[model samples]
Target: MENTKRKIIIVGGGITGLSAAFYTKKYFDERQIPIELTVIEKSPSFGGKIRTLLREDFIIERGPESFLARKMPIMTLVKELGLEDELTATNPQARTNYIVHKGKLHKMPPGLMLGIPTQLTPFMKTGLISPLGKIRAAMDLWLPKKKGMEDESLGHFIQRRLGKEVLDRITEPLLGGIYAGDTHSLSLQATFPHFSAMEKTHRSLIVGMLANKQKPAPSIAGLPEIAQKSMFLTFRNGMTTLVDRLLKELQTEHLITEQGVQTIVQEDGGYTVHLDNGQQIQADGLIMALPTQQTAKLLPNRSSIQWLERINYVSVANIALAFDEKEFTYPLDGSGFVIPRKEGRLLTACTWSSSKWLHTAPKGKVLLRCYVGRGGAEEWVQLSDEQLITAVLQELKEIMGIEAQPIFHEVTRLERSMPQYPVKHVEELRKVRADLAIHSPGVYLCGAGYEGVGIPDCIQQGKVAAEQLAAYLEL
Candidate 1:
């Protein structure tokens, strides 16, 4: 008997891989395509970095905390999984974001969005920037926009257009903390092309942002309240809720975890994936939803994909400490504070989970998620648990003046987690995609390494890859 179903294997069962499987199955069903889906995960768990800890009445996230709340692809999947009711917005009361400057926490101005100022008054009044710095930043309005569209470093762009002061104090830390990257090397095009677009269109980043802010935003009208309230949102219980629901939707029949792929070889106009457990699977098509370098390693052809190997990664760690309200006396009204690279602090950023997410902690308990390690300063990620905790605690004490100990703490070390996008990343990736399309017709790549790093971004990438795979299979 001849089997008619096409064997489509999805490697790496993280959010991106899972999303790909989910969408592939959906698209196949919609198009009436005979498809058999399989998902392989090297880790013991399905959700790659999205680990959530539930202890007592606290919900702590070890990996990513929340994602941007916008009309992105994650919203559609959430609604499909019946998770719209579980969405949780950040606490409205905790509105401020502080920056560590001169060993003191300074409140970031109100009108700053992602460290770029939209309002002049608030930026000029900010304590984090000096009067001279503010004056330099104001020069952006008069500074002529760079003529060429050639790719440049984010640090260079910010410092060139605004000033070195804003880059060091605000934008660098705010954006750097997102990728655990040093903004100086991050590709302006690959990381945030919108910034470049603003410069090209308006000639002044500040004036452009101000104009964009002033434009009347489209009415939300009747969207869910949580979606309307804040720019970021997560599940009420934790981030794992999304993964759990995805598992239920996809079912465990197709998932294979705790199994690593030893190698992938082309066979019979398709592919044969060899697993570490001495098992082989035939695939008519493959959705390689893994790291860029890892995907390149598995492909048959060598030279074309070598550029992907150039993409670098950085290690990071996070410490989550739980405390009874009495133990945390210092006023932590804001969500948290970001430490600039110039501060020479091991800790990069700290999130007041209890204060930020009202649902994360019970009435009298507080949870703090402290970030550790970033580019050029990531050696501490390899520190022993005791040593790391002691050092972080001492720093927290010096910064916030809190002597009380946490009831309990958990540390998560994520090695090689953050993908670095150096200058020319966008163009390089485009060429690689073209090479894959020409050299390896049935193979595709999608994950944090290629386009985006956020959870929602990963989901979108998965959806896109699945759509492309579906189109290829139909052909």
Candidate 2:
């Protein structure tokens, strides 16, 4: 145990880096191993994308609003950090989501799971589909399972199983809203393999969902009540609460803000990290908890960078507007709305934040958060704050019929935030791991790049990286 003392340096102060620091501290502290930890963050603040904006009486999230609690690591961390009471669920009534078709908002029909209709009545009534389109969708019930193929695009799978209407109207918008990705390029194996398995097993997605309707839901510990009620959750304050709590629990010396790593050079039996501000730190182990592109920059000669560079990212802007509830003709109901690419709207998705959680806004006030720009839509990303707000306001006027101006408005841009999971994503990840093993040693990578993209996924990757590092150090 005395020999287990090792200095560790973690790059990036996002949730992944923070989680790694916290878990590593716990492991070493319990084992009586003397460990020194340091976390370097590029931004002045530590939360990274998990930023919460408080203006007047309204609480706005600059980045991700919530996490899907179905993943265990996030929930476990929340409990470990004592944030259980601060967590809240989305409004129960807001469980339903709306989709834009042609030029109007239509309720996404119930019983559909990720664009695959598990029930018949809802699919038949969903106005997004034409009568003939509904018939093509229903034909999936009798159609045989797709024969063996290595992999297929989400676009191709949905078009073959449920028809182009479902892919274009529902699945595309829902998935695109989440991933900000094109269905034509998204891989079913990497994105949503459960649907693929359903097709292979029951020969029909509807039959599989129906047959499993009575099965008990999967367990997710330490999730907020709303998460137990459903699968997703957000804090009443914002996603930043999770990061704040983790930072509070960990030692201050282990964390550093506004210090970005400029480069990494191997030296002696360890490594030396050069900082952008002309400083260097030596560490027995290093964890690069950054996006793939940033990691590529630090490892110029590594082949892993080529594959990491091939994995592209999309920029996004989340515009939050606060308005009086009396101004809206239609009551702000449901979670929010998603715009299908076919609708040709400048925005991607909008969330009724005030409705999604309690205490998000003042009395009689409503907060609407609109997400815009993805893939090739750099025009929206480049828009001035005023221009972006005006564009979103005009769209809201036509879609939700809100005519009044917002009393308060805020805009947040996430440049290259979402990683594109193309059809070759799996191959790229595999190559990355193989290349890293052959080249970089005593160095590891984690975050939304190689694995899942959700908050929980990041936490899980961080914890796994910590365990692997601990094992390598034999701590």
Candidate 3:
């Protein structure tokens, strides 16, 4: 009898796709099932937004710099790939995070559980807010829970519970910096569901957070030493270390870069994936780890994922500059500072890379990464490289009073990369899932577009999608 091998194709060889392929292959290999797996990537490389630019004694991360250490998926993947020793934690002593207010950097109040102050003493002593602003924020303790099951904007939720000062000075910069989104339009439930849950359960967010903090830390059976370090972490070389490891593990034939999927047509037993290079791939199952827009193009039923077309992506740029330690007029003490949108500055945030991660800069020199280009402010990418650098330098001089020029500089622009989850985004995703189930059963979707955007979340999505596909195919 001729052997029958189940074929699987994963589109978009990003971290998500790599993860899906890894898990899927693991499942089939253990069962002694014959399988042919292929991963297609449109870009010249496999990592997608995970790009690292290494120069003379400096590691510049063009994309995400780190992942949350507390998250299990990325940690688990790292260990499985035997890259555990390479992992490094953020500088624990440099724990201070700042927000720019009135052209000055203010240390975030201690005991803050994601912008909500759990301790009263630090909250009261903090100068980030005015006297009236502090009084309004204190009102959160007595304010009744917001009524309604409907989703609301993060801006409205924060302003309602903690006051406008808290929203603008604390929550807006902190949360907006992560999403590169507008707080007034971003979804509370989708972005910070924990805050929403705390409000629903305890009525007062401050009280709820305090109560939660009092509880014991969650336990994991065999977490490594790296897992117990700081909140955010990365490898000594940069985040691309994980990507490089994943790429190395995949077979050359299994990994096909620079091949974009033009269209996917549903056949009797499976689907035919047409490539941009005039090649076609037939597979029993397909995993789409591409962005919302790219994945939408390959779907056979366009109307089913028409809502995906509405998924808006925000462009972001990172400018990494290196300087001698003595070049700065003032001390670069803290981890970094986030510029509030209210500050009306060209730079959104700046990370003291040298202070945050020792490996990022050479000895006796300082390195900083300035973030630019939020949702509506994407025009910064259009500026000439020199023009962009000049604008950033002007802002840095004004904010940090540093007049000296940088020793080295690099610019990276990620166009339409960050996805914005607006209010009612969960409901919209729910409908999209239902439509996919009806119109495209054997097809699967995962990545920043659907569930979550964090590295850990994307890994979890890939794992879940693989398990579901494996079960459906009875492998």
Which of the numbered candidates is closest to the native, going by highest TM-score? 1
Q: TM-scores for all candidates?
A: 0.97, 0.95, 0.97
Counting clashing residue pairs in each candidate, in order, gives 0, 0, 0
**Models ranked on lDDT:** 1, 3, 2
- Name the better of 1 and 2 by lDDT: 1
Residue-wise lDDT of candidate 2 within 304-406, one digit each (tens)? Answer: 5677877788888898989887875567678888998888889888888888765789888888899898666667756788888888899988887778999
Weakest ten-residue segment in model 3 by summed lDDT: 298-307
Worst 10 residues of 2 by lDDT: 218-227
1-475 in candidate 3: lDDT tens per residue?
0257888999978889999988898887787877889999888988878898889889889988999887889888988899888889888878888888899878899998888888889988999989899999989999999788999998899999999999988888888778898888888888998889999999999989988999998877667777786788899888899888887777743888887888888978689989898999899888999899778877755564777777789988899999988876667777999988889998999999999998998898889999997766787877988998999999988888889899989998888999988788898878777787777776789998778899999999999989888886773
Give the CA lDDT, 0 to 100, for residue 303 in model 3. Answer: 63
Q: Spell out the clash pairs found in candidate 2.
A: none
Residue 292 lDDT, candidate 2, scale 0-100: 87
For model 2, state the Cα shift of residue 310 in Å. Answer: 1.1
Q: Considering only N, C-alpha and C atoms within 3 Å, which residue pairs clash in candidate 3?
A: none
Compare the candidates by lDDT and give the number of the best one: 1
Per residue, candidate 1 scores C-alpha lDDT tens digits across 253-357 of 478999988899887778999999999999988999888788878876566688888888999999999888987898879999999999999989899989999
After superposition, the stretches of candidate 2 with alpha carbons farther than 4 Å from their true spots are 1-4, 219-226
Q: Give the whole-model CA lDDT for all candidates, comma-separated.
A: 0.89, 0.82, 0.86
